[model samples]
Target: MTVPANVAAALPQYDLGAEIGRGGMGVVYAAVHRPLGRAVAVKRLPGVPASDERMSARFAHEARLLARLDHPHIVPVYDYVQDRGEHLLVMEKLDGGTVWSKFTGSGVTPAWSCAFGLAMLSGLHAAHEAGVLHLDVKPKNLLFTAGGVLKVADFGISQVVSEGATLGTHGGQVLGTPAYLSPEQALGNPLSPAADVYGAATVLYELLSGRLPFDGGGGALAMIQRHVHHQPRPLVEVPEPLARVIMRGIERDPRARYRNAETFAVDLAGAAAGVFGRDWLLRLGAPIHLSPQVAAATTRPTATPPVVRETLDIPVRATLAEAGTTPVRLGAETLVPAARVLAPPAPARWFALAAALAAAAMIAVPLATPGRDLPVHSADLSKPVTLGLGDPTTAHLTLTAAGITLADVPATAPDPADPNPAAAGPTSPLTFELPGASRWIVGGAAVATVTADGKSADYSLQPVTHPLVSIMGAGSAVLLLFALAYLESVLRSVRRRRAGTGAVVVAAPLGFGLGVAVWLLASVLLRHAPDLWPALVCGALGAAAAVCTVVAARRSALR
Candidate 1:
């Protein structure tokens, strides 16, 4: 798409060149600062209507917050522009390609991957400390300078988590890429620093193993489900200690994972030193900056002789065809384990419980309690007419034969400077048109539809979402979660050769109380929503609680 006229006019100082990148967030262009004779990248956000004060404020706030980050491994923002109808961020430009382009096929060493992870995690930590989250962390966002130094770029989707609010997501849609999503993110639950660490771990895993942890054949939703329910495939031909560090970062439960990026970096450094020697980073010759704690951890001397391995044949992208019995050596004299033994499969009992819960939800959802019909409302379309007037949560729609539009009511009074008072009213601040035969908005799980013909319209709310469904779904999910948690505890006890009778005794009442509490909470919060939202919220919470408890129990068991 061509740049809008306003966007082009907004950046007078920069000579805009060819488009360098484009994605859902916005478009990026290569530009040169006319005064400084330096190249920079300009990211242009889509135009916000003049009336959209909320969005305008949000855009300006986020842009300024991102510009404050000044770490060596982070791409520095030079300036931010908010013109008549455009938003642009100007940042320093690097000529070297992305990390994906650099190491996709070439055989790079474990030392190299470790060094890369250190730098990437350090950058991520800096952002975290500054209350910014690089929600979208992937190889494509890892850019290299001409000198081969890696810098984390593209904070396009990064959210400023200040106080307790963020703009990471719009509506209910997921924001980050599907492949790198943490379990909490995949479930649309509240996010924490662990999410970025998960992304970093996924990247490190792919760089070393040449495949994603959950690289099954599927679309985005399927991939998300896998991350929620499946254990990652064991790392192969990687040093045992390094693999453990990576695995902990990618844990399904966010709490079980690294709490912050620096902790992950420290663990990674120690693991790298154990496998590659204390001076591994120095030997790799990569400009990886580590914190003092991490540097101190890395200084712990290794018993093994220092080995610097570099070879064109070292598989940077290990594939199925490369799987063999040959031991992966670090250098001429160093040796480590050939592969990590496969982790035992998940207990069958847990799978049975999950499958049963899945079956029950599938059967009950289609049979949700029917909705009560609200009074049928009519609108006179000749003048601007508001729909769903009393209920402010739903969108105010401007219906037309072409489609429907989401509009806000004009701020109470007319503009005094207008030529004609009749046409003096302002348009909705958040207005967008969609072309279709019928346009519908969902509240909870129920759909509200307004049909227009020429000048008049009629609308009704469908009864798809009801309190009964919410209670049923929420109660079931909570029970399931608690049941799994109890089972995990019992399983852990059994593995340790203990009786575990306490878990069995407390499971029923604990599950029942938790389920009832969740059901009541959901009923109160989603009373008006009346559709799918109650169940969805409860399910996301239940899944999060269940996974955290189970994972924690399992880890405690191992200990």
Candidate 2:
């Protein structure tokens, strides 16, 4: 927290106090303007020495950029200082601390999270419109005002996107927090507004779910790889509509993500209204500021109908015997305000039921279909026992007093173009001698059971497809297709910006699809007709994944 003597000595007009924070950019110190008696945060650019011309240019660029961004949610710069070998940026001091410091994984409510997002996004959109991208939009950069209004800070690593030029990266390395970097940003590709959108979405995700979208277990490199190649584990406990918005914002492909921060903010406001209520913003009671566009979004008709039932006026018939109050009630009786009931519209209710049924079917089909076992056929090994009846047989099993011998047969015919067709085959068949073995597995399944005498064996032929396994396999294919359809639906629905959807739309079907695939593969390999447990496992995974995805999405979406 200590500043260099020269840095303190350079700023004679202000009193530099203790260090507030430090990062790769520079160290920030609390200060007070002597003349104005105004508190401010002075960031000393020790990393950018006055001797380094390129660094100095970048420092000057940051000052100019910060000065231009005069929005309410962005930290406003007061002065830039360059004296001797030291460079510094002075800005308004926000004493309420940062989101990371106070609310990392705090599991804040949806309305609160969305309100924070609105303020952050409003500022980001303003910056974006001015051709600046805050590449490092992480929780730490989100500082709250004393009134609890969130403001975006630290444009040190921000890039100014102008005509065909970008300002941030140096030496092929992008500067930003790895956990929140967009896929393209992680890959050092040219960035767009979508990158900031991705970062902001990640911040909101953390605020709601109390976790980063990608874990930084393996360090920055691993996180970057995950950002580029992996989908965010679906949010848990988050509402589907809000989750969809976040998902779209953090999509791997920039083209697939939200176009700008303002658009994202509007969608978030709309989603907040659907999940919490039309007066969600009013109810939030958090002193977060909202731009006009975002505030307008709250009144827009949500894609989904209101989830909670409208307040109903029910008439109460008061009887002289039942009423504890005075029995003077007469005429139309009393119409009183009952307890507020929360129920979805009838159509929404039915749709939820249908989704539940579909998810159940996905799990049930795999468990219910008990595949038929392959019949054990006795084979006399005295004569060569062919394993498969085909033009080119699977293998030959020979049981002798010495041991059991299995020889592979060529699966392909000799090339007619070869001058020596006979020589094209292997000099000797590939053979394996299993000494004193009572069972043999082929192609990942136990296909043959040998007798103790070793002269005869009970063998299930290779490629013996069980009708049930085939059915399950075929069903798996269907589930896969269905999952694809669901994914498409997710994308389409997100584009339409609908709200009030449960987690089933995206997470449930996708999980069911994965379960179907696992069940089919495991069932086919195990080949035990009665052991249908794999189906149950499949179902369990599907259910658990649905729950996990739902939970994750829910917590992340609306909290």
Candidate 3:
């Protein structure tokens, strides 16, 4: 197909620098927004048959969908315009390439693959929450920026779910990439969130292993059949945690997969947190199977040891049998020839000196010293309290206490003076302030103990004091200073090792010392100032630490 002249004219405004990518649906160009001084990606959809109104409508629908989606991990659609019977969608131009490119070429690392998968899952979850589904989700649609932010792009085949609206049916459409299609989508069933979940898993699998789960020379139909009938090869080589997550995600039955993108993200997060085996399976609400593969993976032979099972732990035993050999069951306590052994901690006597010193410190420290009690007294109800309920009809409360204070109270209270006080019971635990006292008083304490009739039965309120909270805050500052110093020393050593002894190492010590000084100054201010000044001081110190660390790291990297 020849490039339309009118489309060519619209391209100049975008300062069409070069054609970056092209697909059956559209042609993406690298363009410069000259006036705004920024680069952008301009995707222009070519004119299709006017007879096929369904295709035209779907294309327009995609433009609308892209406009509505505004998320950090989603490619932002800047402007959508039509020129010369062609539609153009301008988007934020990212310098880095697509996940597809990485998957096909030098495969991404496990950490990066997991990270990218998690980010894409987050974006998909956001779209799902907004009642939109990217019908076609694949590696090609995932992009990476120069700053390492992963973005989901190309919502060309997305479907918007609205109240009382049926699924897209024009031209008998079955929209999705075949390799990543959910079983329902492959079978041309009405779509749901599970479709996206399946597609995401396929993309994740590709990202991790640089290969698709199913591939055949028999073409798209064959691949679809495989998706519908055949089980995917178990992701045994991949990390067990990730493998388990992917397996669940690509389950043959849509119902067996994650219910939604959010749930999938939660499982992915668990996998990333290194939870595996039966424990992780239980967390995922899946049944556990003691498979031979699992046993082999967990067990390894060592020269110096015969394996011994830990107390209350189950040991998996297996033996290679000859063609006619009979199987035998071994007792739980029976030690096999080549079993792996686990050991318990050494006796407490080994650390006797350390324990004695710790005991001495505990004894020397004063448990408690009599200090002025920060009295928390209840309201003096003897006087005309004149409690005013904000909404009297709703039975709102107005507590007028003297010395007692309420922490973490709701903003509005129900009307306590309501004729129908039953409504207030639900919205009880209201908090109010004293007329001239410094402390805030809480209402509805009686409701917690008894009903409005005030009969104490089974309720308890304990006073919580954190005298060590401030002390810990101070200790944190000191630890931070020491950490910085230690980090500087490590960096210095690293530089000396890598670039030789004479290499310049100036920023580390300087940054660490400056951080320590700022922390000390902030601590002093915190001790002197009243109110929430301590919190502010801590925040300032934290910000300073972050800035210093970043700057120092950048400088060191440059060196």
Candidate 4:
């Protein structure tokens, strides 16, 4: 085989095989470690000039960042070597395809969608924590492992965030994949982890609907304009709860969206759990089942065509041993064959139903007793509480208590800009610190202190988030949600005389019950401190979940 100039350097350590993937950055070749015989993918950056100082450092920075991150969902980097001035980024070879490579017109199921989101979120969360930001997040950037884990890949345009500094120092001046750019990013404004949130949400939206939220047939510039100002098409195909989660995640206002990728992921997992419970991940299963068209698209020549399409390893150990001789489903949209649709276990179904009934019973029984009203206005908030603030993050809150001479509780108040969400809304604002808001935004510290009479006093203050309200409201929400599911199942079963209809009917309530039950318990336990921001957040979530029940039932009926 004729070794390309870029492929020569890797030849010593890695037996470079056929080219499997290519992009504007460079071509990707399959290579086997000479000593270990481990399969890997080596991407040689043809665009990065070995002579350019800034570009070289930037590329090196990206390589170091990826190498530092250790997460199952983020692809690991084995080595970054500039073989003769041509940068070669050797990575743990993934066999599953990219999400875009196998995106089918049929769209992704809710369980799979949430699972994929969770995997991606887990990776992004790790990146954010490590002070790295994935500026370009899109379907193409997400690769699946042979085992079907969605791994976040491609930090080509990523940058490191300095401690306490919320803004990024790299990739700011340049545009990344325009389709997934956050509104703030598109406008060329300062960015935080929230920008990545928008990108993840965008790709997830595409995965769920099998289409881009903002379709820009008009052109790239026009599409950028739409991304900046456009409202996405309504998500009626998905269950309403899932739809609301997606909508909120992609909110135009960064604040309106989940504070970070973590929150976005939690909601997705929560909603999926409600529908699929502990078995949600299983429901998503794996994806090697690619339609011929999608599989073909991955390998087809383009202006910047990838050498490998969906590595079935759909982009993997089984990475096309022979590039074209073997039809490899290289990248995955994370869609398994429809034949593998595993129905919920019988015991799981019953367990979900029983839990739902228990919740409903709790709510119903409480209502019959006098003075059992939920506590909305009443909550205990007399104690002082503190949450941890990591490096580059700080906190300051004024404590005023008469007769309780306070110790040096910083006379300074937390920044108004970084107001506590729990302090204001019916829900407590999630504790998220922006890298850009080090000097201003006030975040809760991990350790809080409230001293009496100029000395530190022992005290435990719970968030005044009204635990009664949280519990009672959660119970009521779940009860209503279950009722809606049951109604829908009944209607759907009657209309569709298909075989195994009873199982479908039973599964509807069970899926919804598990989801609602899990959500209820999580809400109650997590909101024990009684923060308003989360309450409001939970309220919005509840409404969305309820709406999902109605829409899902209606859609099932129509189907």
Q: Residue-pair clashes per candidate, as listed?
A: 7, 16, 11, 61
Task: Write one digit per residue (lDDT tens) for candidate 1, span 1-559.
Answer: 5666776798888788888887656688888999999999998775432235765676677789878888999999999998867778898898888877655545456678878888999999999999988888998899988888899998877766664443255534467777788888767667778889999999998777666788644345677788899999886547567778899999999899999999998888887787777776777788877789988877664344233334322656433322333454432222222222122135445644663564344334424533335454332222333442222222344332112333223222334675764333232222223322222332222223432222222344222443343433445456656655675665555444242334434443444344334543333334322434434544444443444344334434433
Residue 465 of model 3, lDDT score: 24
Candidate 2 residue 399 Cα shift, in angstroms, is 50
lDDT of 4: 0.55
TM-score attained by model 3: 0.47
* CA RMSD of all predictions: 24.3, 18.0, 29.9, 29.5
Q: Put down candidate 3 lDDT per residue, 39-119, tens digits, no spaces.
A: 998887755522356666667776877788877788898888765567888899988888766654444555456566767
Poorly placed runs, candidate 2 (over 4 Å): 48-50, 105-107, 163-173, 306-559
TM-score, candidate number 2: 0.54
lDDT of 2 at 370: 55
Q: Which portions of model 1 miss their true places by more than 4 Å?
A: 1-3, 47-56, 165-168, 301-313, 318-559
Cα lDDT tens digits, model 2, 1-559, are 6678888888999998999887767789999999999999999876544456877887888688788778888999999888867888999999887876555222244566677788889889989988888889987898988887788999887777773334355534457877788888776677788889999999877665545677555445678889989889776536677778887888888888888898898888887777777877786676665678788877663687445422111112111122333333212232111111111113333444544665566556545665446554433322334342322223334322102233322333334686864433433222223332222322222344332222333445333444333434455556766765675565343332232244345565576566656566545454433234555556556655554444333333321
Candidate with the larger TM-score of 2 and 4: 2
Please, what is the TM-score per model?
0.55, 0.54, 0.47, 0.49
Ranking by TM-score: 1, 2, 4, 3
Model 2, C-alpha of 209: deviation from truth (Å): 1.8
Better of 1 and 2 by TM-score: 1
Instruction: Report the alpha-carbon TM-score of model 1 versus the true structure.
Output: 0.55
Order the candidates by lDDT, highest first. Answer: 2, 1, 4, 3
